[model samples]
Target: MHHAESLYEINDDLTPELMGRVDEVIQRYANRAGALIPVLTECQKIVGYVPVELQEYVAKGLNIPGSTVYGVVTFYSFFSMVPKGRYIIKVCMGTACYVKGIGEVLNRICSEFNMDVGETTEDRRFSLEAVRCLGACGLAPVVVINEDTHGDVSADKIMNILDQYT
Candidate 1:
């Protein structure tokens, strides 16, 4: 069991209503074997991200160790402890994209936004991520911002593309 002081401070967005939803999800899956993943998924859907405080809460609710929850979260790329921004910017880092100058595109974005891959902007506007591929090899050097994809992107054109989001 973790002491209160050792747990993460819950954010304001984690309202009673949200916690109630999480609790209901937990109750539904707590007794089932291999329930952790689904429970976490449902919680993430409600909370946007699964912070440590929520993890501990889920652990206790499911009668599982917090370390196990932490392990699963850390092992999964889809899981994130920090809240994601409104827009998620995914830059393809595949061989084709890299060969087509995605590195420069990524660098330009990082320099302009003052953020690295897997980091959200200070204003919580954009979150940048480097992905292995987007499966658009024909459209190499793809940058997907939110649901829109820009193929054959150039480094100099990144800022122009980002302007459309705001």
Candidate 2:
């Protein structure tokens, strides 16, 4: 989608009350250079991601320069530039997990969904990510779907775990 359209599309998920809150925030710190962070925090809360166009809108709304907003957003990893999927799949690639046949598990996921790490599916139903560890070394070969953790997972177990999200 076009970047301009993407900014307005954020309103689709944001309630009128939330948008009003965003407006209030902008008005409150319209003149402060440091207001960029709070404004972004509110925007991210209302819309899960902070796309480039939204950054521009926030800058314009607060009479701040676009570069100022862009700089702050890019500086933080918590602020996502791209849209996130409803289900976030985190595969543990830590040393312990990797040694325990985690490679096969990762391969299975890549083949099944045709997706690589940091990529989301076409339907936007799932986003695949690989993390260093989930602190479940005991449960090596761990695959986390959102908050739920699946440990000692095998290629066969992947389907059962994914079915929960669908």
Which parts of model 1 have CA positions greater than 4 angstroms off?
Answer: 1-9
Q: What is the lDDT for 131 in model 2? A: 94
Each candidate structure's TM-score, on Cα atoms with residue i matched to residue i, is: 0.82, 0.81
- Tens digits of per-residue lDDT, candidate 2, 16-40, equal 5555666777788788867888889
Candidate 1 per-residue C-alpha lDDT over 1-166 given as tens digits, one digit per residue, 9 for 90 to 100: 5433334334665777788888899989979999999999999999888988889988998999999999999999899899988889999999999999999999999999999998999888899999998999899889999899899889888889999887
Best by TM-score: 1
For each candidate in turn, give its C-alpha RMSD to the true structure in angstroms.
3.1, 3.8
Which window of 10 residues has the lowest lDDT sum in candidate 1? 1-10
The prediction achieving the highest lDDT against the true structure is 1
The Cα local distance difference test for each model comes to 0.88, 0.81
Q: What is the lDDT of residue 139 in candidate 2?
A: 94
Runs off by more than 4 Å, candidate 2 = 1-33
